[model samples]
Target chain A: MSSPERRTADGLERAQQLVRLKRYEQPDEGYFEGFLKEFQQRQRADLMQRSSRSLFCERLGTYLADFGGRRMLLAGGAACALALLFVRVAPEGQPVDAGFDAPRGEVTPVSAGPLFEGEIDLWEGMVVPAGDEEIDLPLFMVEPFDSRRAAGEPEIIEL
Target chain B: MADVKKRKPDEDRGLVERAKDGDTAAFDELVTKYSPKLYGLVYHMTSNHEDTNDLLQDIFAKAYRSLRRFRGRSAFYTWIYSISVNMTLNFLKKRNRHWKISLDDVDSAIEFDKEFIEQTSKTDPVRESNIHELQLRLNEAMMELSDDHRAVVTMFDIQGMPHNEIAKILKVSPGTVRSRLFYAHRQLQNHLEEFRR
Candidate 1:
């Protein structure tokens, strides 16, 4: 390991020397006053803009605790999970038939009156009645059928 | 010189104790005291005023946050510089490689260099060209060094921080600081050779 003194003749030393000398070089009194004012202005603006909390501390602490040097993998995993959830949770164009797979002893064929008239909740797998007034239908009117089989065969409704 | 040397150790210890106790005003005073020197270190490394300013804020904020963990392993100044250097290096890692150094007009070393040269020389063609050209070359050379190398060079060559202090700041041996400085200076010398006679 060489000392900076070894490179004293080097242009780097000269540049460093010039920079150091400039420190005490002292700007003209007017320039110094103006410089201090501007410097203070910048400092104040910077203080205002800076978050009260340190990003380096926040980011580094988060990375260490949550990501633990697997930031890419963790972030990728999170993104994939979000995407899958979106695909599953997003509303589909076609209304789902809740009566298709009613649990045993439950209504197998639940009619909401007219085709595609009402919305279905994929969450609870129930058909919601559309328009005004409640359409009276027995809870167990239709026999429950296998979803796979019901799906294979399209329902024929009478108006 | 004797007074500074005598005063430095006690002052460093007192500042560290106050900072550890969560006195923000004490820490701010420390920032005011050391910011100029650290600014030189950060500005030379980043070569961008906006980035340097941002990085400086982050560095101090980091030190303030991690004050509890500092543990008196090094002097307060060294510890803060360590935070400053590391934060700046990480920022450099994330910074766009294509972004050139945005030299500041307020404290440009090139202006000092030009003034120094005009005072010293009779007819030097190299330094005589538009100061703009020289500033560009010097800053470009500065921007080329790796972050670690640049930090050492910035602290040692540009800022005049001694190797022992740098070692303490970087949490390394003086030998390591010396080696980094040597290599960085060599690299910088090569880059700025055009400025030499």
Candidate 2:
């Protein structure tokens, strides 16, 4: 026998030519009939599988609808309860009554505490300084308290 | 095997319609009617009789399940072909591995061809033998193609489907179908070039 590969090549060429020439034909009746039979059997089996799966899905749906459905309802209910619980537990930042605001212009000043006692006051000896020369007390001379500082500005605070 | 007289074309059409409408018996009739072709398709694509049998079962099962969704956009035959092609491609994808091409046990066409060639072999053994070898190699080369290429080849070359019909079935443009056939045939020619000698 010639090399199988060589034979195979010839056959391949012929087949391609045949296919190209539109000479390729379907099988004979007996073969088709056999195929039809096999197809029928397969279809029946397929139908059965589909029905089985359909039945399974239907059963599953029904199960979910019947006894098992409560789980979802319970889940929904649990979610609602948790949400309400969170609403209750979480802090509310609404402005609490900054009790009554006095009318805009009706401001009041409080009485000062007692003046400096003897030992700490070298200031008691000094007269009120002359014109354009306001006497600078240590309290006044020190840098004024910055409101931004008191309100937490300059986030990088020096120790 | 007891022969089940195949349904007439019109009856087959009706069966497909009924099956599409959720009639199990009609679908069963269709399965009976077309199983062999579909099996051949799956078998050729998979190259394993057992795998073909199993895949055939699943293909029909899927077709039956999805029958309700099959709009008669294409002929039921074309529609079923589409299903077969899709299923086969899906199977190949899931396999993610190379598969060899295996023809069904010498089809009548092959048998007849063999007989004709052998008769001629008595006079020109070398030439005829070359042809036989070439055909086998062609089949082997065809099988070595990716499933997509193989599918287009089967439809166009083996089944003699029109480009339009194949395009519709494959959900691709006719140009794509033609290009695939061209490439597949070229590959086959190259693989079987020695036979041209």
Candidate 3:
């Protein structure tokens, strides 16, 4: 490798020196002042847009993208999943909410009168007390299915 | 010179430490100190001012965001410069080749520069070319070089950075830096032969 000083009179040196004119290419007057102000504005906007929590989460996400951190996260996730699977697979375990006193009798399906005629009986088979007027559930609001309207199968409703 | 050299990095280290501790003012100081230099680096590589300004902002923002991970293994100056050069190089790759060369106005002080007078005083083709024409031709010649070569030329020639510092910023060995400069200079000479009498 040759030093630039040792080749001052050569064409390479002249070309190198010519490029020195590039130093004069400064921005317009007051550009730096404007630049700094614009930068601060941008910084404040950035701060307003992204909270420290998001910044930390972004950094954490970046850190966890690396090999060691990814492996650690994967191990932790596997452990949590294993704990969940253990609890779920244990049939002898008590129901999750044992204290909530949900109704515990057989719920036989009930026959329904046509809706729209206002003869719908909602509490026919459910074991509510005879005068239990507190359960004021609305009847189904659809028109009765017509035998003449059974011409075509219903379109599959994509959930 | 040696004492000054030793003190600069220590000063930068103090600022960097403070900035890492969430001191926005410290980071602003760093930005104020390096923006002009990095602006030159990006502007010369791009031959466009708007792109340089945008890239400079992004470079500092990225540095501030990543400051916590900066481990002082390198000087803050070198680390920021590394980020600057790499970011500019990546940006150049994505920049459109057909984009217009929107140059910043040459500083008025160039008229009184001894080197500029000497350069323009010669009876060569360069002396016949006006400043605007010269700037265009020179930028065209530079843009002709490959991105890697152009980066080295911008650092070593235009910015007057030492080959070792450039090597540090570019993460290449000094020999590779020298090799790239050699070839880059050769290419520029061929393209800008008007500079030679």
**Top TM-score model:** 3
DockQ of 1: 0.08
Model 3, B57-97: lDDT tens digits are 99988888778777788888889889988999899989887
Clashing residue pairs in candidate 3 are: none
Candidate number with the higher lDDT (2 or 3)? 3
lDDT score, candidate 3, position B47:
75
Those runs of model 2 whose alpha carbons end farther than 4 Å from true positions after fitting are A1-15, A18-159, B1-13, B20-22, B96-109, B112-127, B130-135
**Tens digit per residue, CA lDDT, model 2, B1-197:** 01112322244567877766667778777777677667656655654556676677677777776665555656677777888899888987887465444344323354456544553355433355554444455557666777888888776665556687778888999999988877777677766555454
TM-score of chain A of each: 0.20, 0.21, 0.32
Model 3 per-residue lDDT tens digits across residues A1-159: 376655544877788878887777677668887888888899889989997899889788656653366689789999999989977886785676655789888989977963223233433522233453544444354344544456676655569
- Model 1 chain B scores worst on lDDT over the 10 consecutive residues at B1-10
- Top-lDDT structure, candidate number: 3
- Looking at candidate 2 chain A, the ten consecutive residues that score lowest on lDDT are A18-27
In candidate 3, stretches whose alpha carbon ends up further than 4 angstroms from where it belongs are A1-9, A51-53, A59-159, B1-8, B100-119, B122-125
Error of 1 at B22 (Å): 4.7
Clashes of 3: 0
